[model samples]
Target: MSKNIDVLIIGAGAAGLICAITAAKRGRKTLIIDHANKAGKKILMSGGGRCNFTNYFIEYERYLSLNKHFFKSALARYTQWDFIALVEKHGIPYHEKTLGQLFCNNKSKDILNMLLNECKSLGVEILLNTKVNKIRKNEIEKGFNTKTAIGDIKCQSLVIATGALSIPSMGATGFGYEVARQFNLKVTETKAGLVPFIMPKKWLHHFGDLAGTSVNSQVSCNKHQFKESILITHKGLSGPAILQASSYWSTGDYIEIDLLPEKNAENWLKQMKIDKGDTLLSNILSLVLTKKFASKIVSLWFHNKPMKQLSEEDIQYIAEKLKCWKVWPEKTEGYKTAEVTVGGVDTHAISSKTMEVKSVPGLFFIGEVLDVTGHLGGFNFQWAWASGFVCGEVA
Candidate 1:
């Protein structure tokens, strides 16, 4: 048998659910299909289960895109306030985390429940465990037909909200990119974002033992800088600061980290030389950071030299090391632990205002499937909400 709908949304994710609900509410016959048995699997695991749904301070600057300004239209059309209003309407209690990021007061389930409840209220049809086997465009009707395990489904407007390949264990795949390619849409190269870094073998050999030891530091790569906690690991490094910097860091690019971010290393070292002149460099580092981390760093750099016996040049070198410790990571942990994918369908071929394909009308793309990616702290979720809402309005 064949099913027909006004709009068929692929992938019952955060974006797909939102788009489906919005379209159905507008009296459009909307159907959402997903291979996964359940919806919002990613949402259930986000923010450690609390789900950071959106940010209070949403700006275009937080997003990273090749065009850099392609997200402005949809984001402006459906702002963070609009999502906040939806949350309020659902009566989901939420609180603002640091830096204007918002999280559910209860659990991630609250956000998913809100979305699912809205979908039900709008009478949107949702099919779970529905695997799509093939997709072909109906040239006569200028529509797309999707052959699924269940049956064939046709729609005037088809939205690909399958998202990017990030958390594969949660059923992530490149089906969206594949579908785009089938339609001759240009897809940019993809990489992992918001992932951990893997230091060189030499650095790992020395610092691997300091796994789980974390400290606050300022991390910089490219033009991006973030002040957050960095945790050393057996593999290399992972933490908020490292993850934030990883988005901007590419292979072969060196990352600069200020270990003692708040202190002037030169001045502090000089003061320590006067106050505890006989103290060993390892002892001084131990006082500032954890003993294990200090010992490893000092042993590697200063050879555990006594502060009183060290020459001025040696002290200066130590100061420079503390002030600007450049970490030339061997590579990132890749998509295995990445929170989001960094690239997708090119923006040049799509309408920024409607998220519709410029060359292929009746086709739309939304959410993380597009090249538009946001930084950490709920920015991506806001993008999901904004893009889905706007696409639904126009789909």
Candidate 2:
């Protein structure tokens, strides 16, 4: 019931699969194990099944980590262009969606199949539906004995690519964090990232009426601003802009949203008063924003007044409100609805260049298990590829 491998990768997710491919290609005896029935469950469902595999524009600042610069080395060594080339090599057609986010032309399964094919070509072993019960590192022999439901696995190097607690229904768990703690590694405060915000009851009542309505907006939080469409949800605010800002948001913090990012509201209002004095303020707003939202704004702020009735002060006030509408979020939707986990095993204790535990040789952590969380888009997947590739080179 005991098997030995040169490299043992836990969790046959994005990182583990890539790591196995890399190691096996290098002639190492690699085996990737996962408890899931099949590999790449997340990848199959990501980006509405298209899978945003990597971003066209990648930078070090796009990732959040305790050590901001830790990802630079791996990312640089395994660039997005490299992955893109591989995808092209496989003849899996892909296209850029927006803001440099690339997605498969068909389905996420294409990306998964590409990785699987590469691993197969290299003779990598993938054991699915196998749960690891215990992992004990042998200090004297510099190896690991991992007990699983299938059997006992012994390996010279162990790679923990088990992702953090993001989507519990997808079988996501804190197994990676538990493994890190078993080895006496430091883990930072964890929270949901790339999640939608739930507004206060009063605010929800007013905005919930506009649920399903989308508006072009510029949302800012924690000094980060995103210009995209914000959707009004029954629970609260969502859409790309709101979701991007949510990564930087905490409870009690207010988010500033520019409803009219493309226009000078004050100047436009003054001109409207001169040209169409008979028009209602709500009518003017309806031209740019949704009629329901405009009517609500007029009822709440202007008392449904006509354009001619507003004084210079009122004009200025309305303009300022449109430019900087602030709203406080009660809380996030939590990990159940989050795209990724914000914090994880502290990067300071790991070698950024090798993705190896500095104090514990042959032990490695990669992908979402690390504290590094990428911004919305394909950045997270890119991190998985880069970190896994780097670790496979040495591990």
Candidate 3:
């Protein structure tokens, strides 16, 4: 059995759903296919089920792409406000979380339902639990023939929005990259982003005791810094600050953490020595960090010394260490626990405006499948909406 579609979208994800709705609204016969039983699995689980649909403050700087300016065109064309308006049209109640992140007041399912409803209203067809067995592009006809478990699908415009390899349990796969490769498109090296860092055995041994402890800190790596709460885990470190820094972190890279971002450690130490010389170093540190974490640090660094026992030189050294607490991550938690994928289909090979392959006219790639990755906030979702919207307009 064969069916012809004006636009065939692989992967009924955030990007694919938006693309289908946008194109179908333009009177195109759009069909979205996914291997999963349901669409928008990621959306259903994002932001602890509330779904950080988009960020209030979105800019090109917030995204990481081989071509840094590639996202500007699409993002500007379909701004966050546009999606916000769509949410309002659906009458979904949402609130802004910290750092301009927006989440639904009820559940993530509301966002998914809204997108599905939009697609339904536009007469978009979605095929769930349909796995694509093969895809071939016809040179003469200038179209694509995709064989799936259900049947053969032919389309004038083919879009690969299969997403990236993140959260495999939720059905994330590298099918998008495979499709890009089949079309001779360049795919950059891919890695996990917004993931937790796994500390080396030695470092883990020292800090592992502080598992479940969280502190407000400024964590920096590769010139990128995030000031948020860092959580100490049994495996290594996690939380907003660590997760943000993990995007910029490479293996063997040292991340510096300002344990007390509010205070100049050296100055504060000097003042403390003058005023409360009898106090133990751990006790003073406890004011800023958790008691267990403070005690562990003092035990390892200062040999459990009292403030009065330390000389000026020792005090300065201690203060400097506190200001620049460095930890070398052995590796990231990988795609299994990553919030997104860092690298993907090379943007240089695709048109930034339409997300269409420059060489393959009717083929397009968008969302996490592309090299564009956003920061820890809702920027990723914004990229999905923007790129999908742009591609739908043209493809």
How well does candidate 3 score on lDDT at residue 393? 96
Which lDDT tens digits does candidate 2 get at residues 7-121? 9999899999998988888889999998899998999999989999999999888999889899999999999999999999999999999999999999999999999999988
Q: What C-alpha lDDT values do all the predictions have?
A: 0.89, 0.93, 0.92
lDDT of 3: 0.92
Query: Residues 114-219, candidate 1, lDDT per residue (tens digit)?
Result: 8999888888989999998998888998788989998999999999999998988888999999989988998998999999988889898888889999988999
lDDT by residue (161-247, candidate 3, tens digit) is 999999999889889898889888889999999999888899888888888999999999999988899999999999999999998
How close to the true structure is residue 69 of candidate 1, measured as C-alpha lDDT?
A: 85
**Cand. 2 Cα-lDDT:** 0.93
Give the TM-scores of the predictions, in the order they appear.
Answer: 0.95, 0.98, 0.97
Model 1 misplaced regions, further than 4 Å? 275-279, 303-311
Candidate 1 total steric clashes: 0
Model 2 residue 151 CA deviation (Å) reads 1.4
Error of 1 at 153 (Å): 1.1
The candidate that wins on TM-score is 2
lDDT of 3 at 339: 97
Model 2: runs farther than 4 Å from truth? none
lDDT of 1 at 257: 87
lDDT value for model 1: 0.89
